[model samples]
Target: AAGAGAAAGAGAAAEDVPEVERESPAKAPVARRRRTVLLAGTAVVAAVAAAALVVNLVPDKGHNDRSGKQSVGTAASESVDSSPDASEPSGAKGRSASPSASRSGSPTASAPASVSASRSREAAAAQGGDGSADGATAPAVAVNPYKWEDPCSQHYLIDQNPEQVPPPPAEPDARGWVNALGGVAGGQQMLALTVQGTGKATVVLEALHVRVVEKSAPLAWNDFEMGVGCGGGVETTSFGVDLDAGRPSLSPKAGQRDFPYKVSESDPEVFYVFADARTHNVSWYLELDWSSGDRHGAVRLDDKGKPFRTSGNVGRPAYTYPLGDTEWGRNESYPDIPG
Candidate 1:
């Protein structure tokens, strides 16, 4: 009986122990897992919020970067538009004026002077001054129409054997003479006259008058060796004719010989006279008279059929007339002589 009672007492003691206390180990692990899960969920939410905040910060930098690029683009466009050295023609006028103000010694110095004058006129106009902008600008000059002359129509019969004529006296004051004899040569006749200007200003060739003189007149004779194979002797006379007066005369003064000839810039004027020898005959004399600036001058052919300036100076030949034979005939018809 006493042993049964002790066992009962021990069983009661075991029952008296708390049920929560008995399951504490397993329940503590479950509670720790739940807390871990909650903590993990909170950490995940913080990471997501941090990523969103970083994304928001990135947009600001991106916006600033885009804005900077746009500003740079705008500046580049402005620089290009206002560039004085731009090649666009539309900007030429503006560029011409600006560079003169900021810089000097450029090739556009002349442009600046003109621009300053235009600006002064504009300022005067703004102040209600009498300067008219339109009047301040020079009017455009009219260009003359280019008309080709028919040299073949001016052909005349001349003595091919000019050596038969008597030579002029040895005295410098004595005049020479010329005579005409009929002859024909089978060859091409091509004449080219080229006039070039080297000055920085425009050259005006006003009143270009040409005339043909007969061989019966007294001319200044000079010994000229013509290398052409026309069977004509080389002894020739150097003479000058007044193209404007349509008369043969002696050479003029050196200063007077350069009259009516102006050269500006580098443009060249070319005149051509081509004729097949089968149809046309060689003429006697070719005289040229022209006016340039305030001067007038005349040119004529020497005895050797070469044109030369009357001044007898040898630097730059203001005018050149080269005559030669053509290997092939031109198909174009010659125009009639002008009235």
Candidate 2:
């Protein structure tokens, strides 16, 4: 019975060890491993979701910022293109627009204002009333009124040797008198005379003589004279001859006489002479003596032919010399005569 009791105690001690306690050690390890795996999976899922969110948010924000910049650029470009005054000279426009663009950082806002300001400045400069140099306006240059007209268009010459003296020879002689005094009075005379050489010069007409000659012999002679009254008069008693001195004078019967006249290289003075011829039936000739400063010269014209011929019809009661045979020559015509 003591042996039965010992077996019973051992059995009781075995019974005190619970079935759950024995399984606890093996199951605890498996449960703890599963819990650790679940926590690690949850952490991995959270990290992936966070990474995706950051990627999406960052791109969207960047895209929005880029879109804003593009919109601003487009608006600025449009404003610059559409502005009315923006077409001004590129340099000026650029300068003006720079300030506005720099201040506003918007192309649309600054370009037009800059262009307008530039235009205003240009307009002010053009008007010349203000915003100009010294407040003085430029003056218009004066033009010559007689530039296109012939100055020596109307004039004539007459033989003025004294009637008492014998007439000159038909052709020029060694004396230089007859040859020197032969030609139409106003024929081919210069409307403006060109004074050449150096220094200031004075143009002076010395004398005039007219005579009726037949075959190189004098028929009638008359010295040119001047009278108080100008224009038409009796041939023998007209202004061609001086009434007081009974001699000829170089001064023109009509026209300006101011001498030592200022002249330019491009423009010169023209001269003319006038006289009366109503008397003789024979062929006639004219003699004109002239001096300019130190230069002395003479011109002659007759009724015969070129380089020495009368232009006006001698038979006519009154005559005025044309410009074809004057001292300047036939090449000179109206308007070609320089100022």
Candidate 3:
């Protein structure tokens, strides 16, 4: 089964930092994970990433007590890059400097929200600053990015003052709450993408690659819970990455195919990527390789125009505004999601 919540963690900072955002998909949004990777390992684990993202907590008193983390994809046109790379993708730990990207061909693409800046520069520099960080997408077949979730999709808000955060209503606007506070998604970062060929041609999705733009010490921030509960199964071509690994690779999950799928305007394929970090806050994105007829190219998927971020928030001060609760309280317990 899959978890919920869109996530992007920032590196350690002195005090208040602006939040960024997370998503877009044209084909299908697989069940947006409510939990992070720890919970996705098995339902019995519940969303360990939800309440149990054991990371260093922010100091009890500071500006971060009122700041939020960055999220992704609030606005943008859905289209393939103008110039596509014909080379195959290598979404692995040892990826080359060459870059790839994916875009949506429609304006109706939807995604979840979260973000980071210094890491952005690092990612651009690592990629040789060839405009990949500027959101200048190339042209190829159309593809959608982001997992499936609504405005109320569960998420974690780091280092926000409980006093300023409004009380939870009957149905708390999770996304709106995070956005208002400028908090980022904590724990794990999950991504979903819809890829297809153009016109009547069937585009072959050769491979999906992973690139780590930057890595830093995990943020030490107070954890605010948005996860109400978790329920769902992995329904797409699922893959996993361990951000803590010396060389992380995009390995297929249990019972999941690696890549090499087929799609077209009439037929599209959706992929779910689960990434986790145990020791570092990481900035990353995906690259895809597609070919139709004699023309083939690669596409890069990121958070709006920046690299998506995620971190391991383990034992931070976890809090929640559970159902029926008017005020935010300590997250003393977690749910046991069925596998």
Candidate 4:
């Protein structure tokens, strides 16, 4: 049986054999050539990978900048060596000492010129008086205007008179300063120009009901940066009087004739006279044009340029010169008016 099976297998194998295999022993060489081609391909791939890795591992070269570094080389060393000397003045060896330093020739004779000059300036300032031209005894300016004279230099408005009124509700010791507006009777409502030492000035008028209203500072004071407001009260509005106008007139408005105040001009000075309705008495107020050499003449003229007169209802006590009787100052000159 085994011989028969072997004979059958040989017959089948002979039948399956291809014509190409039967003709050649060249299969081994073909396989070897294929393996050689595969090896060559692998070598090329590895060489390309190695070249890429080399490029990635190495870095490019660049410029060497020293300026950004804290310490550069020889240049920096030279700069460090010369820096301190360069800080000195170019010709420092020949330069003289400042005024504060004196020569060594005489030790005790050398005064500190700077200190001496400072002392002299201080002495001059002390002698020249304070910021105000007036010496130290200026008025106690509880409430005062800008252009007011030294109240201390001159006597006050209300001397030790029994009739002197005390300050209003808030302040008591404050003395009544002479109102800048003269010939104003103690209680009369008059328009007044008042000033304070703060470099401020204002115009205020007392109305019929004793209500005070502040008026605009004249354009001049506003331009000068002076303050503007109605002064606190009667005692605050101090002034240097132009007392020369005596037997002053008191005029009232045409409609309100009962109250009287004076309005008149003597060259550069203008006066306002009024009645102190509280005391049922008469008084006067004077206003001087400090800038003009004479009184503001036009103020005395009516709108129609008529000589300004007190209204008829403004009555007089038939007594002589109430305000003139009070002492004003050394240089003040009183005006003469017919009673």
Candidate 5:
């Protein structure tokens, strides 16, 4: 009866407490879970705010690295490429030292001086400049139209005959032999000159001029006893220059046409150049003027950068090596062969 009365009293006290604050009659532990959802929501909001703050303050390391690498790469490229504002670097000395090699290696400088200068001017004009302030020339284009034959390949008239003609040696040896003989070319030199374009663009050959470097008496070192066959063929166009003249110039044959000819890779032109020196030993070269599009230039032609030399063999000493004879014999008539 005492336990029942105590229970009744506790139940009457529970009725005074708020329903939400009252524990269930089953004795479920509800206080621990009451605010669990609200706490979880507050924790999530705090984590998101911290993440946003970090994102706004820190920069991407990878992006910065790439930008730095790009700047270095740009500088490297600029060093390799030619700049229109500066003088040539030491690297360019190789090109300037060997004009002949450069002439053959690149198309822009391969042409005559006038044509080369003209092309350079036109290129500068196109870019709104007049070349570099330091006087550096323009870069070379890949295409070059000048096709030169070996100077030693062509047959030359040497007044001196070989002691014993054997099979010819290499071209270098042949050139050396001519030099050893003190030969300035006897009779005439027949040079086979060919011209074409690098691409489909046509090049116009305006004129061929002669420049006289030196004139003197016929060389006595070339005085020899015998003469061999030294003849060359002719083409549609041929020019003859009289080295003995006061001012030597190119003259066409009676039927040959003058210059202002056009040429391309598919349609090349072959010209036979005949230089005669009957009285004076002359050192000279040929100047060729040409143009293509807005580019014009002139080029000098010679025997491996040296002027073409020729001398008249009017009254020089002569010898004869008859076909059947084993030793050289003196021919009574020098500079003349008896038929």
Candidate 6:
């Protein structure tokens, strides 16, 4: 079986920051992180070449968080000067910046969720939910549900807080919650989420989508199976998610492809989806997820006849989550994600 793999990339920030009325005080955790990175990352300083360069390099924190800036398509251009020779290392292996400056996490596209603002909490509740179809194997899904279970909270922006923007509901339509995002090419599953703040948010999806396409004796498209619905605390502004089944049977394995795992030449399957938040006109994509397994997800069925999901890089960065802390991975846990 192949582990799951998903990729989420923040495209670019918008041209201008839209002003808002509220002034969120700096939170303790955010302050700590900011201070730590500020003092530690000397690379940020070396990137500034001249007076004109200095003006654009700093990220604006007053109007929105870093997460908001990252989503804006042009924010990075506004901050850093583009030169053919400017490059920096992210301090991670297999990751380096080039003169043109493309940022990525290890060979994958998972960046961190750059949300550093205030946040509130609510339990994961079912909204806009309908009973599953009897004998329907498709996973349940929630389309554009309320960001918060507490419908009356200040951050719950569906209807209660008209002026506020809520974290993206899992699906775009605000209708049903499926078990997972449907499959695409490369044996991956994916869904789409819209993040709208100042468009400055930095969404780092750590998983990739895997799909199974057959050229000969193609299986009926109807035979495709998926699991959709939101139950975990994984966060993104509504994500395009999918699962992969690696191996010939229901057994598990590591990484994308192995020699024994080769498919028939006539029907070689591509098993990865790169979903990015950057606004672009490219054919490839970068997605975000909560586990590295999301990155290793497989499309081919394993020996046990069970499908497998790869881990995405978007999960908590630490090796482990805080024990007994249910809020640890909550989507609303991030300040930008909404309560």
Candidate order (TM-score): 3, 5, 1, 2, 4, 6
> Per-prediction count of colliding residue pairs?
12, 39, 56, 27, 12, 115
* Residue range with the least summed lDDT across 10 consecutive positions in model 1: 311-320
Stretches of model 5 off by over 4 angstroms after superposition: 1-176, 224-235, 320-328, 331-339
Per-model TM values vs. the true structure: 0.22, 0.20, 0.52, 0.15, 0.52, 0.14
Q: Model 6, 1-339: lDDT tens per residue?
A: 122222211111221222221223346668888999987676556665455576667666684555654455344443343433223444433332232235422232121122111100011012221112111111111112212211111111111121132222332332232122231121222322232221112222223333333122211111111111324432322223222222111111233332222222122223322222111111222322221111111112221222322222222211111334322232333323211
Best by lDDT: 5
Candidate with the larger TM-score of 2 and 6: 2
Candidate 2 local lDDT, residue 293: 33
- Steric clash count of candidate 3: 56
What is the Cα-based TM-score of model 3? 0.52
Residue lDDT tens for model 5, 1-339: 999999999998887675746557434545445567678888999999999999966878766555665556555545444333245466654443234233333555434443565566667567676444322232122211111123322333354555643333344365565665545566566666776655555768788888999999876543433333334445457778888999888888758988888876577787877787777888888877766665556667776557878777665554444456666555554444221
Score each candidate by Cα lDDT: 0.35, 0.36, 0.55, 0.28, 0.59, 0.25
Superposition error at 125 for model 5 (Å)? 6.1
lDDT of 3 at 246: 81
Give one digit per residue, the lDDT tens place, for model 1 in 1-339: 999999999888878776657799878999999999999999999999999999866766545656765556555555555655543466455544334333432333233223333444455456565233223221111111111122222222123323442322222211122122221211222234454543343445443333443222212222111121224211111112332233433342222342344444355554432222221222333434433333333444223332211211111111111145322221122122111
All models, RMSD in angstroms: 23.6, 30.0, 38.5, 28.7, 17.5, 36.7
Q: After superposition, how far is residue 104 of candidate 2 from its true place, in Å?
A: 87
| Model 4 worst lDDT window (10 residues) | 218-227
lDDT of 4 by residue, 1-339 (tens): 899999999988877786557556677778889999999999999999999999866653453343434223444444444444444566653434321122222253122222322333344356552222321111111111112121111111221322232222111222122232121222122233321111121212212111111211111100000111224332332222211223333334323333222211211112222222222222222222111111111111111211111111122221112232442222222121112
